[model samples]
Target: MHTLLKNLKVEINDKLYVKDPESSDLGKRILSCSIEMIYELGFEQFTFKKLGLAIKSNESSIYRYFENKHKLLLYLTSWYWSWLEYQLVLQTLTLSVPKDKLNRAVEILTQEVTQDSNFSHIDEVLLNKIIISEYSKSYLTKEVDIENKEGYFAVYKRLVLRLKDMIKEVDPAYAFPASLSSMVIQGALHQHFLKDHFTAITDCNSTTTPTSYFLNLIDQLIISNGKK
Candidate 1:
């Protein structure tokens, strides 16, 4: 078994090493490499040995950053959430009105699904698999649920809350819950991603872009609900 260190200065057999930004970069590299490998090969087939080969880094270097594969997965999840928050902030800042800001947020999310090369082609399938699996596990394990309750869900939650507030301003009698509004927004944004199997069952045009559908849906929802 590997021995644990107590402080920033890790001592192994009278040797001391200081962790720095380079170490952090190394950790990120390892996480990125692991994500790529997991995308190429399913998680069950992904291994540290394979990841090291893909990144051209030694396993010992990776171990210095992460204790095991599970820890690496957690790190990847955190990285995704952090990057998503940054994206949302950048998108939200471009608009002045709350309604426009929420609209832009939906547009950004939809555009991300189609335009982001990270989620394009085969990588998209891999990512969807990983997201579905992680979400299910998080739901069951209570770790992610706990994190959400503790305010780690602030970015996404705040985006929804802002949208709900806008809806309220437009119409006080809007009866739908914020959660339902958020889901509808997300569903509208993800329609393209879900179109493959859905096409056979529905007559809706698949040619429409996610951003267009999202904005149209938001406008219609607001107009219809405001009259009630």
Candidate 2:
């Protein structure tokens, strides 16, 4: 993880520190620094000075691209979701059967969570912190609240819609419940991070990979839904 962070820092520095920088390249570099800052320091701890230092630029340069830290955080979150959306779209294109598609989606998502060093450490912590902090502050926005409407929500909604479509395809007689499935999937995928808590509650072995367990649960859900 440290090595990955170091490499990302070097990459950003190279892109932003050129003697003659292209406008397009500089924009990307600042965003990259914002991402790195969010990863290194939790979002709450992230500051413009740190980002500026990371990219070999100034706070004024960053503000030229993003109006404020909130906007930069939004941009970072957008980038994360956009990448996820691309991956999901690619996975969707390759599968014909709905059940198979859902299975593949689950596999792909779990694998991503397990494999992404950045996500495994930084993004996951930031996500949990945001949820907890925002939820407690009475800031939990409705699904379609305009103020809360962002790229992350859009990607999440699209995933749920796709899952709903898959459910309908697999079992047309039953009403497809997306909320349940979405919750299940999130809980499953993040189980690795929550292993200790899960172990305390379920008294299960702490060493098991959550992704494997998640896949098993998804299979059972599909079978159960098929019967209904």
Candidate 3:
């Protein structure tokens, strides 16, 4: 129920869908129901047919929005990264401190997510879960290069590069800005997965601790490492 932005579009790659899902009511329903069903049933079991039934639309209508489940997955992942890019800018731009901005970036990557009510069809919290669990499937396919060529990976690359800039601001001499930034983002996602599916692999006993752990780790790597 964030009230600041009212129904703004989080643009995804146009090629991921046969038709734009945000352009019409049925398309919107396709998105909303797909997120709901995917979150409930998991990406492996979720299908356009099942999603169509959830929204009381025909399978053909769902197909109009996406080529297959994989495209829908890419569309969802692209949307999430786009949303994250906006949020990172919004949360960090006001700060005058480099470490503070970097710390804000860590929190966004690691902290608990809430459902963003702005996009009524998309549950960001649930979509985040899908990203943590099922995102690899999008790239693990044989068509990954083809998908990349279609702009499926653009938002993710942009997000990582923007965060990489914050790392360089903290330490211009840092040798691995891109590597470090991507590590923090993907590491946090891995921690979430471990905490949920393999508790013994992670020490986060509560929801808030992942944010602390990641921030401290970033401080060690970026802030403290710069001093040495």
Tell me the number of clashing residue pairs for each predicted model: 0, 0, 0
> Could you say which candidate leads in TM-score?
3
What tens-digit string does per-residue lDDT give for candidate 2 at 49-113? Answer: 88888888877876666666655554444344444555566667867877777667666555433
For model 3, how does the per-residue alpha-carbon lDDT over 1-228 read when each residue is reduced to its tens digit? Answer: 235457557888788889998899998888777877888999989987788778887889888778999888889999998998878887887899888888898898788788776777788988899888888888998888987887789999888898899889888998999998888888878888888888887887575477888888888888886542
Task: For candidate 1, write residues 71-109 as lDDT tens digits.
Answer: 555444443444444556655665676566656666655
TM-score quality measure for candidate 3: 0.94
Q: Model 1 residue 200 lDDT?
A: 57
Worst 10 residues of 3 by lDDT: 1-10
Candidate 1: the clashing residue pairs are none
Candidate 1: residue 72 lDDT (0-100): 55
Give me the overall lDDT of model 2.
0.53
Higher-scoring candidate on lDDT, 2 or 3: 3
When 1 and 2 are scored with TM-score, the better candidate is: 2
lDDT of 3 at 126: 87
